[model samples]
Target: MFKEIIFKEDAINKPEKGRLPTSIAVLCGVTILALCTLLVGALISTQRHSEGLQQVVSSMLNKSGVENPVTAVLLNFRSYDTLLEIAVLLIVAIVMLPQATVSKSLSLIRVQQSADPGLIMSSLLRFLAPTLIIMGGYMLWTGAYSPGGAFQAGALIAGAGILIFTNVQYQVNMQSFAFRALLSIGLCIFILSGFAVALQTGQFLEYPQKYASAIILFIETAATVSIATTLLLLYLAVAGTQEEFNHDA
Candidate 1:
């Protein structure tokens, strides 16, 4: 009986080893074919005389109430898309949060001695955190006329949050009310702005040209805060899960 069981297990494992290579080869071939098809399609499409959105964009910038074309497109021309994107990020952060029954004690604990940062890292973080915050604010401000925007700003701020949380002594409460509020504030502002515009123009998100820049700026500011908070919470949630697993082990 022991020999039969061992033979059956070996047979099962042997087939998997053979099938694994075959499956990998098939997947590789399919991926290569798909990529080639996409490249060819791109080449053919670009060769055609296609009157793209350039003309429309040129006209849009004049009435967009912003000097930056990219900003105008993101916050004005296609703002509904940006709103939806923010909602998606909020949903992801909400999903990542620990369950209500999870013990508060298990949510955060001291970093393992092996993973603790040395003096140099701690000193660097002190300088980098403030610099990142200032840079993020600058990015948000310059989004109106240059390359930076809320997304870039949010990422920088999130990086700073990550540095703070990774230090041995720091902890963030992912489930706190203030954190939740900050995470949702952007979405709230976005929805309210849409309704306000609807009240005036009978169309959702259609900002008046006179107030377009101001409205966009307000939305961007809220979005920056919400995005940063949401991302930081996500990191904390992931780190908490890992810590829980390690404790269990």
Candidate 2:
């Protein structure tokens, strides 16, 4: 009698397959409201004076020294915003790494039978990774005078790290004390340097005189390493392996 009662209770609690009528009605209402809002916004933005805003933006972008105006606006004129953006990104990465279980240990194991890549693919990826890394560094170095900046360099560095992660099987000390220290070091440097700049020049992130280039370079290099490691770790956490993958050239 107890077993039958339990079974009946379980059946009662089980969800039905189709959407509830109330849910369907709510979804339809939301969709209709969203469409109405979008239409209204579109009409409002198309007013006669809108082109004036466009012209002003064009004039400002043209005056910016960097070649790519969007890049200039993002990394130079709006740098404080960019700094907060990067800090948020770093926080999100740290939060995403799983630690509730010993799942990270599983990532240290190889699943596929290891086979050496043929001469062509191996040579190709080897050459490509370094080339991209160098190009990324160059981009960061010239960012103040040219189009590219830390974001672009960091992206390329992460791509190279991905290549290295895939092309070699090795144990990573993801949870090591040293690794944690290294992970936080980049943010520390960025914040400390910004504060120093503020103290010396009364402007946050004002590259100090005679060391401006060096400061930017240091920040970019650290950013590259931090972003690369974080991305590689995230991939390992998700895909579950420290084994060399053959996804690259």
Candidate that would win on TM-score: 1
lDDT of the structure predicted as candidate 1: 0.82
Candidate 1 residues 1-249, lDDT tens each?
022233764565542222346678799889999999999999988766666787798787979978898999999999999999999999998888776543444444334545557898789898999999999999999999999999999999999988877786555555446667788999999999999988988999999988999999999999999999888887877777445434432
Residue-by-residue lDDT tens digits, candidate 2, 64-146: 44445555555445657766776776786688665633333333323333656567756867799889899988877777566
TM-scores, in order shown?
A: 0.78, 0.62
Sliding window of 10 residues with minimal summed lDDT for model 2: 240-249
CA shift of 234, model 1, Å: 2.2
- Residue 176 lDDT (model 1): 49
Q: What is the lDDT of residue 83 in candidate 1?
A: 92
